[model samples]
Target: MNRYQADVPDGLSRRARSFVRVHGLRVGSLAVEDYRSEWLERGIPSAEIDRVAAFGERWGGLALPPSPRYNGGPRFFTPDTPETDPSGGWWFEAGEQRASVPYGFMIGPDGEFGVHADRWVPLHATVEGWVESLSLTYHARLWAKSITKLVHDEVETIDLTGYVEVPEVVGLADSWWRGPDSLVAIYRGEAECLAFPAARTAYIYSGLDDWGLHG
Candidate 1:
């Protein structure tokens, strides 16, 4: 049972079509443990790890060190390159100020395009299993929300797993929040929260009432 379908129209680039199809499934099945292991195996420097951890702390409210392997490997979006600017997009400073979160979108060699956000959480290995499961589940919800929002008002057709024309408005609607209470609330509230359609546009709205955070 293929879980997703794209609503692409004609005249779209072949790469775009390919991007939609490949990502449609890959994004849903992405695993956090797999991501971390790949990072370690790649031998990313400790300094980079510290930098990533600090970035997470300042932006996402979590302390996540960069994986040992800094180069290309399996990642949600391409791993950050030295040329990459951490200050742009949803980095710590921007997310804190309520600026728009940067979603990761890439055009494949085949010209297909996909969107994703690589997320890292500060979880010890003892509980790594639980963390991976939770992250995959969250990724699915986030993707769904983005898709739904993209075609919400119009009945436009899209290919579930193929490329489609880029929408004029591509952006995330929410911010990422970090904190013990926020994390717990998001987990508890996952069922009720709407899924995101694309990678970057999805927002992690914290402070739910049911989690006893507000009450």
Candidate 2:
């Protein structure tokens, strides 16, 4: 049997299996609340909090309030769309240089269940010499303003490691529902390598030692 078939537990839906197939491995799973706390601990400023708060005030309270039960997880932010065609959004930055990467959350609509955006680079691209090395993509949709009576107020942390064989499991969630799959590689961090997936939200971290992949 393929390693993935062996590693993947039974009971995942077809959609879920498709997700796992596109991405290699499942790193670690956690509740939305846990993910948020980790992001904060990682030094990501609470930029989303301020933005949501300001929006609420400007709009005479938010159409929906932030809820961890629905929307909260590791998030990416972009100033605008990366397409040659212009889309009005935020520009993404990596160190001193800037790229047209999109940034957002990996959460559900009700303001609970997933990830959120902070001031840090949720998904970043790496450059090696004249060529771009990696590309991280993301997709998210709003579920509801709140799910249960309880309101959410935290981000979640999804631990990532290098060496997952599937592309979708490399990052966080699978990108099946999102438009199309995207790939990204991190060459500067503790893991220096490249990866590609059919989805934007998932990734495989291959540690620092093994930087190349071969069949």
Candidate 3:
């Protein structure tokens, strides 16, 4: 059986669900007790534990496709591997970069997805948002008439004057904006949050319609 065809965990956007169905490679699943034991012992909330368990049952160790704008795709982990943030919130090591990056991906107390380095830098308000953003990137590029990438200082020049932030992704340092005929994605997670400003990047997907933006 194709593991990718297995049901995706709930609580994700339609786009994210589709992406996981089409592209996800499920390595394995973890039991609920895997999370409850380690996290509950540390005073992690029960509600949050439920959410992680649900996600882990389907998506744990799932391998995602690479993002052109980012270092590497995220490889999700089981919730048994837990860590505490310097800010005093207990977090689960939800995912890590496929490439060698100094920081690891984390799910904070409030279900926010971020990287932990000198400090925690939230990339999105929720783990679902992160998956949605990746799905959008994959979808947008397929239908976009043209794509443009900006690096370093050039990323600062692309004006978002009339663009509106896309709400589904719940962006923080990393964001997606929709213009009249284009969608712009800005990646500042490593640059702004991890203190590597030179790594700033953005992508412009132009000549899009309502369907291209939302379909």
- Compose the digit string of candidate 3's lDDT tens values, residues 1-215: 67444457787878788898888776755676645777688777887677777657656777777766547646655555555666786677776677888777777778788777787878899877888888889999988999999988999999999999999899998999999989999998888666888889999999998888886
**Per-model TM values vs. the true structure:** 0.18, 0.18, 0.85
Q: Please say which candidate is ahead in TM-score: 2 or 3.
A: 3
Deviating ranges (above 4 Å) for candidate 2: 1-22, 28-100, 108-215
Position 197, candidate 2: lDDT: 22
The residue-by-residue lDDT of candidate 2 on 1-215, one tens digit each, is: 44322142233434333333443332222223433455457644456433333222222111111212112212211111111113322222211112222333321211111122332222211111101111121111111121212111111122323323233323222211111121222221111112222122222222112112211
Q: For candidate 2, report its TM-score.
A: 0.18
Candidate 1 residues 80-156, lDDT tens each?
A: 32112343322111111122333332222122222234432211121122222223224333332222322221212
Candidate 2 lowest-lDDT run of ten: 126-135
How does model 3 fare in lDDT?
A: 0.78
Name the better of 1 and 2 by lDDT. Answer: 1
Candidate 1 weakest lDDT stretch, 10 residues = 183-192
Q: By lDDT, highest first, what's the ranking?
A: 3, 1, 2
Candidate with the larger lDDT of 1 and 3: 3
Query: C-alpha displacement of 29 in model 2, angstroms?
Result: 6.1
Distance from true location, Cα of 76 in model 1, Å: 5.2
Model 3 Cα shift for residue 138 (angstroms): 1.0
